[model samples]
Target: MSKKVILITGASSGMGKETAKALIQEGHTVYTVARRIDHMQDLKNMGGYPIQMDVTNENDIQNVVDTIIKHESKIDVLWNNAGYGLYGAVEDIPVDEARKQFEVNLFGLATITQKVVPYMRQAKSGTIINTSSMGGKMYTPMGAWYHASKHAVEGFSDCLRLELQEFNIKVVVLEPGVIATEFGEVMLKNISQFSSKGAYSSLTNQLVTATKKMYDKGQGSKPTVISKTVSKIVNETKPKTRYRVGLWAKPMVWMRIYLGDKLFDKIIMSQLS
Candidate 1:
């Protein structure tokens, strides 16, 4: 595998952090970016450069690209991984919260990718790997906003893949299933804050009960599982457009695509049992 200069966002925790480490171990130069500079210090210690960046801010996004270029001269891979899940019923979540979710998850990712594309296009080679979720292709009750944002990412990635093909810029979408991380904790907190006691209280309650147990039992795959796939995508000469990794990722997505929507809906609701 050739040594590539890579930029990864949301590197303070979870899959992003793990991927940064794996890439560096594979002899690549990696720059890790996130809002919590302190949290990324560990990543920096592992031979990765950590930059404080809030993905929702356009200036921050541009600065990250600029900083990498100033040092590395080019960006070979962009792991556009900055995002969060905002879980709540569609009617229960505030309009502002929903929009904010898109701002961070969709708009920020798109902006950063756009900023880097020019550099990639000039070089005539690059890859943008987006960390979309399995929920992008499937949905569950009380997670309307989160699912919507991921669904948008899936579509956006497809469009990007087609457009950048001519430039020899590969666009890959990562659809991860349950990975052991703070993401679940954060999502639950959001749901509790917004939908715990309203018109959708029963639905929210059931979701919380089911999801909390699953997370507590630690059923999700480790972050390293995704890191392996990331390494493969970067190393392969002819990488696929999408890599659905981690536990239950493929099964969940395939079931939804082959099975009817009603059957999938029942299976989703059965989680409450």
Candidate 2:
């Protein structure tokens, strides 16, 4: 296989970090970008280019794109994976905070994709792997903003795939279920303000407790599972539009499709409760 130049955002941790390492191991020139440069120091040691990037910053994103174009001449794969979950009821989470979540999860991702698309178009061969989640397809309590962002990604990726087909640009969505990561901690921290006396308090606590338990018990899939799936998608001659990996992702997608909204809601509520 020919060596490809790949750029992955959110490479400081979780699935992104694992995927960057795996891609580098597979002989790809990997450039890993995230806000936490220190977290990616090991990646740099392994020959992966570590780029300090806050996806929410338009200038920083544009700079990364320009840097890639200047050095590599072309980017074979652009992994849009920098995102976080803000878990809280829609009514409880501050509107501005919710908007901030969208800025990072939706707008930021879209901005980077826009900057990279022209290069990929010129190359006429590239893959864009977007990191979505099972919540994108199914409803989950206390994850309104996060779910909305992933749903947006689902739609955005679908549209891009259709539009870029003629240009040989493949848009793949990686939908991971609950993975053992610091994601839960970040969600908890982001929604702490909404944890007191409200209609959502009990539900929020239940959901948080369940999430903590799952993480502690190691019931969720490892980051490497998703990383391996991403590697396969990047390396495939013809990749599928969506790769739903991890334990509950497939089941959740099937349930959402087959059981309808009401039943699925009941199932999810029961699981959290």
- RMSD each, Å: 0.9, 1.1
> lDDT tens string, model 2, 1-273?
778999999999999998899988898999999999999999999999999999999999999999988999999999999999988778878889889989999899999999999999998999999999988998787788899999999999999999999999999998999898789889887666676458877887788788878878889889999888988888898999898889799999999999998998899888886
- Pairs of residues clashing in candidate 2: none
Give candidate 1 regions above 4 Å deviation.
none
Looking at candidate 2, the ten consecutive residues that score lowest on lDDT are 188-197
Q: Candidate 1: lDDT of 117?
A: 96
Q: Per-residue alpha-carbon lDDT of model 1 for 89-184, expressed as tens digits?
A: 888788999999999999999999889999999999998999899999998887788899999999999999999999999999999999999899
Off by over 4 Å in 2: none
Best by lDDT: 1
- Which one is best on TM-score? 1
lDDT for 122 (candidate 1) = 98
lDDT for position 273 in model 1? 64
Residue 5 in candidate 2 has what lDDT? 93
Residue pairs in collision within model 1: none
Q: How does model 1 score by TM-score?
A: 0.98
